[model samples]
Target: MPLLRNALTCSLLALVSHIATAAEAPAPVQSLRPLLTTLNERLNIGDLVALTKWDSGKPIQDSPREAQVIASARTLAGEHKLDPEDVAQLIAAQMEANKLVQYGLLAQWQAAGHAPDTPRPDLAKQIRPQLDELQNRLLRQYADVAPYRRDPNCPVWLAKARQGLTHDALHDLALTRATGELCIRAAGV
Candidate 1:
């Protein structure tokens, strides 16, 4: 029951810290308009305003596994006392990973010179380390902000508790999400 006990304690601590932090000095939230607009233009997707939900756990494609993943994320967030900042960090990490993948794809495409829209195999090979690095960053930042203590090597998810995170980082988070989305769309993922 150590894991469960630890999770409960972390959750309570996060909630308390958030309340105390708010009472002492309110944190500022940033606007992501430009980032959204950029995402729409780059991805040729729907209006940024239309996509209000920031939960990455939402079904990207309908599947039981996706639903379970989303639920698991929610449970972990509840148990571990994650906050919106944690979620932003997670998205930001994902965005970075997406960029590396895109770059790898571009490199492969250029090497081939087959076409402007050709696919490449290097993307799969290169994205793993980038994702790993992002995961590490998320864990470090989470440990810094939240009440929970994360294992140095443990991989933690960040997209669950993404609310009330109002800071300059929001811009970066949006850009990262947009970039990742663009990369995925470009790569047809």
Candidate 2:
């Protein structure tokens, strides 16, 4: 019966290993937090954008650049088999949040006597590349949530989802904009 005992022991070890792996894996909520955090991080870029624009005397509201970004985002969505509108909405909200931060920072800088102590990052070279990486991540995040977005309980689920976040994170308008468009409730459902 030694062979039988060894087989059973190997089976138990395999089962334990699988269970441990599953336990260590992130929950669905954990998966979603990154998406929200990415939105927040995207908003973080606004300071750089604002600083660059301020030094160069560029306007905060660049309609043409925003339009181009939206168009490119939608195209990326199509390639990823996601809804373009969903992608566009998220991008638009993100842009809105970004501008909010930009405007706030610019106003603060204006009130101050000089530029920030740290030298500003270059918009095209340093900042846009950061945005590009975040965009790719955001697209992957969109894919992960596409199924849940259609669920009837999306609004409720989203509302519940916020409870998992910290107050400071929630205070960031990026989280608001990111999750708001995702929580679209069906009427008369």
Candidate 3:
């Protein structure tokens, strides 16, 4: 009886160990934080953009500029073996979230007679070029993590990943919504 009990205990321990290993190995979402950090950095450009647009009286939604960005993103995605259409959708989500921040701030500034708390950034020189560079970095980060797009738990993991980065309540909600949309594209959920 004692020998049989020892054998059973060993077998149960081995089974539990195997199960834990498998569970730990396949969680693809574990690698998503760096990618999410890149995204958080990208979205943060929106505040400076809003300030610039506020100073210049530029509208938040520039369809032509947006289209140009979309085209460029698709080309970049192709270079990284990411699906162009999916990449476009992802970029659109980011852009729309960016615009939401921009428009909201711009509206608030307008209401306050253009005296925004955020200092105006140079749109033509400093801001635009910085945004272009950040776009490239963001695209590269997306490519690195693109393989895990099929993970069913992507949305949940992504939400968890951005917890620290999403500082502003409104902007954080917009970022979450945008990322949720991207996850939907990835998993068709």
Candidate 4:
């Protein structure tokens, strides 16, 4: 009987210790939420971009624009004290995600024979500025969570942090693309 009680006490103490450790563990999900939010916002703008392209009969793949954006991101990364290559990758992921959304929406509209009758914002005059502002916010938030990029659970945290931010399957996929560069596995891990 004494042995049974001693074993039970040990088990209970072990469980309590595990619970405490889990409770104190760093929450990478929370830290990454702001960056995800900004990315989602950027993804949402893909709708506007799609609408503009649909009406103008413009192609979605704009190489010059992509190059410009990447250059700007690298410059901004320097200001943020982050790796320029990494930031460029992140920004490129965002653009790819945005393009995914644009492609999806354009396809839908093409099949329907008409685009949605929504107010169209000027891509250069209005939308670009909004995106530029988001870029700044995204870099700031990225700086905050940059340390967590090496966390083993970053992908898990990113998956959790993305919940409820997307409106449809396309956006979900876009979000997935946007976060592709967010977490890098550590060396030999």
The candidate maximizing TM-score is 4
Q: Regarding TM-score, does 1 or 4 come out ahead?
A: 4
lDDT of 4 at 51: 94
Off by over 4 Å in 4: 1-26, 187-189
Provide the RMSD of all predictions against the true structure, rounded to 1 decimal.
Answer: 17.2, 6.9, 5.1, 5.8
Error of 3 at 151 (Å): 1.7
> Which window of 10 residues has the lowest lDDT sum in candidate 1?
46-55
For lDDT, candidate 2 versus 3, the one ahead is 2
Cα lDDT of all candidates, in order?
0.36, 0.77, 0.76, 0.93
**Which order, best to worst by TM-score?**
4, 3, 2, 1
- Considering every candidate listed, which one attains the maximal lDDT? 4
TM-scores across all candidates? 0.25, 0.74, 0.77, 0.85
Estimate, for each residue in 1-189, the C-alpha lDDT of model 4 and write its tens digit: 999999999999999999999898667888888899999999999999999999899999999999999999999998889999989888999999999999999989889999999999999999999999999999999998988888898889999999999999999999999998888898887
lDDT (10s digit) by residue, model 3, range 45-155: 888888777667777889998899899988998777878898898889888888888877777777888555756668768877877787787777777667566667767
Question: Please, what are the lDDT tens digits per residue for candidate 2 over residues 73-103?
Answer: 9989977888898899888888887887777
Clashing pairs in 1: 29-166
Worst 10 contiguous positions by lDDT, candidate 4: 22-31
CA lDDT of 81 in candidate 1? 58
Enumerate clash totals for all models, in the order shown.
Answer: 1, 0, 0, 0
